[model samples]
Target: MPAADLPLLIEAVRMAGHVATGFVGKSAKRWDKPDGAGPVTEADLAVNDLLHKVLRQARPDYGWLSEETEDSSIRLGHDRVFIVDPIDGTRSFTEGADTWAHAIAVAEFGQVTSAVVYLPMRDLLYTAARGKGAYLNGVPIQTSAVTDFADATILAAKPTMAAKMWRSGVCPVFKPAYRPSLAYRLGLVAQAQFDGMLTLRPSWEWDIAAGALIVAEAGGAISNQRGASLRFNSADPRLDGVVAGGGLIHAALLDALA
Candidate 1:
């Protein structure tokens, strides 16, 4: 069933990307959330609306959870729920940047079964299904094989590298990088473009659900900042944080944080 759902997710995410691209440089209306959640543009809502209709119509029984849609407890009663972020990097999209992405995933009883993360402007599509391998633009991808922390290139925010967060009171020697889209950062790790990625602040489920599967399917390990397994479709959808990389690097990062 997960395999079957993969195609549907891929198609839905691609269409969402298409819808989003139409407004990329066209000055789509922008506004901010009341509690400083972040800026949102009309493009984000348009894509969210399109994905909701297309995905829900195809699987009416499946529940839905999306950044643009209001939260509901009804999804908790379903075995499979759709988790989505119409535009992962709204700030980038509003600024006419190509790094924004559409992230969609199917979580069955708290575990991701199928997922797709698409960046239309960049023309990169990442996809995965439970047990099957991850792919980028239809070609298989794998995490970086580098095993030493000193040699790793990690995608993360500046705060993630703060010395206070590490047990040694010093950051690792890996090259630090930044990406506006959390989903895209995870995909980079899956594609071996970056050895790993993390954010110590709590992360929303919609932002990382799809990328989590992609990294795992690509022969990488992904978990919360505490090195605990990630489970989706929960009553509270926010994750403690995310840390993903090749097995050794992933373990190393967690140990450093500890």
Candidate 2:
């Protein structure tokens, strides 16, 4: 029954966003993460450092887990943890695409208690606290009311469409949206801009934790591909995937993907 630390979470993300915005378009050091995986820029490190210091100082008892930081088994010992992605959609950020966001969430007992996803470039703030509902720029928001699967508008990847990931090899009625930031995609669903959003591949916790809570509080449902509730601050810190939308649309999408 504990409530989310909404105010602190919001402040931390906005502070991180400031550091991110300062380096969005300007020149900064960039490199691969040893495995030739994804790109990491100076902005990511700067924001991560600031959040790590600020949030941990504010809540010394909370554990820390972030995309930019190396995984630490020590976090597993705590009942509460701060899960963060300094900048989701780093690809878009590095390219100055204005689609990146700072994603942060507080997880206690395997569920997010509070969350925030801030897109500094767009000057948008999406936030949610457990049992308090969700909001976008201080206005309450909800998911679309579309219940029919055929009419549901989904945000998805081009590859998913080409591979026919949907049930019966049929895509949604409208063109699938392509947003680089997974957090932004979920935020959009919370705002009812899209009926739902999905991904079949494994997703990092930092990528979807904040967004999941936001969607859930906005009267939407969130779960992995199997429709299982997502648990965070895990030792693995990764999820099978995500499927979220308005109540009925969510159920229908799960049925389709199933």
Candidate 3:
């Protein structure tokens, strides 16, 4: 693990985010991926191209995996790889919403060794390193200790798919705040703004790689709905679904979701 590469990784992601922010509301161009539901704007491709170029030039050894590019099985061979989401919330990006952002992280084997998330619209940068702790704009951060579900600032996507799953036979009164970007949503958890978050469907590794590390280093924890720690570099790219808050309420969220 070239753990020493944290600074370079952070700088690359910040620069990549700045480049992506340039295209907001400009109506440059856009398209969909293989699936018609997944939006891919010109900014996504542009930022993707920039990240590929910069990250490759900075750390030639790190394998690359991103949303705008094709899948690669070569990452299985590298102990460390750069997992990136050029623009995590393309829907919000094209809509000129402030919820969108960029995510980048270094995964050693399956663990995230470092992470950096830049919210382009908000000009916010969140970062973390394994065992080193998390920071939001360089200020140290940690998760909320709110154990009471009624008081906990719950968060999740709109329509509340996971909320329905949790309320179907349990915790019917709990209401989690709906959020857009998975990075920013999870960043809220790492920053202690929210206590728990639930994701109903599977997500790409890039979307949560940096967020997961932010949670971890902030003295919080994360896992798929089944309560498993997240890992990157799978051929399918759909890593897993649903991660609860860290700290005391995590177990409760897991039990309710389970």
| Top TM-score prediction, candidate number | 1
Q: What is candidate 3's lDDT per residue for 1-258, written digit by digit as tens?
A: 435767887788788877876775447587776646588888888888998999888788889888778777887788788898988888888887888888998888888899988886787899888888899998999898878777877786654544357635545345568777898888989988888787868888888888988888888878888888787777676766857576777777777763
lDDT of 2 by residue, 1-258 (tens): 225488988888888887888884546678888876598999999999999999999889999999999899999998989999998988888787899999999999899989999999899999999999999999999999988756777898876665367677776565477799999999999999999988988999999999999999999999998899999998898899898999998887778763
TM-scores vs. true structure, each candidate: 0.98, 0.95, 0.93
User: Higher TM-score: candidate 1 or 2?
Assistant: 1
TM-score of decoy 2: 0.95
Please identify model 2 stretches exceeding 4 Å from their true place: 1-4
Question: Could you give candidate 1's per-residue lDDT for residues 2-80 as a string of tens digits?
Answer: 9999999888888887788888454899999889999988888999999999999999999999999999999999999
TM-score of 1: 0.98
TM-score of model 3 (CA atoms) = 0.93
Candidate 2 C-alpha error for residue 78, in Å: 0.5
Worst 10 residues of 2 by lDDT: 159-168
Clash totals for all models, in order?
Answer: 0, 0, 0
As for candidate 2, its clashing pairs are none
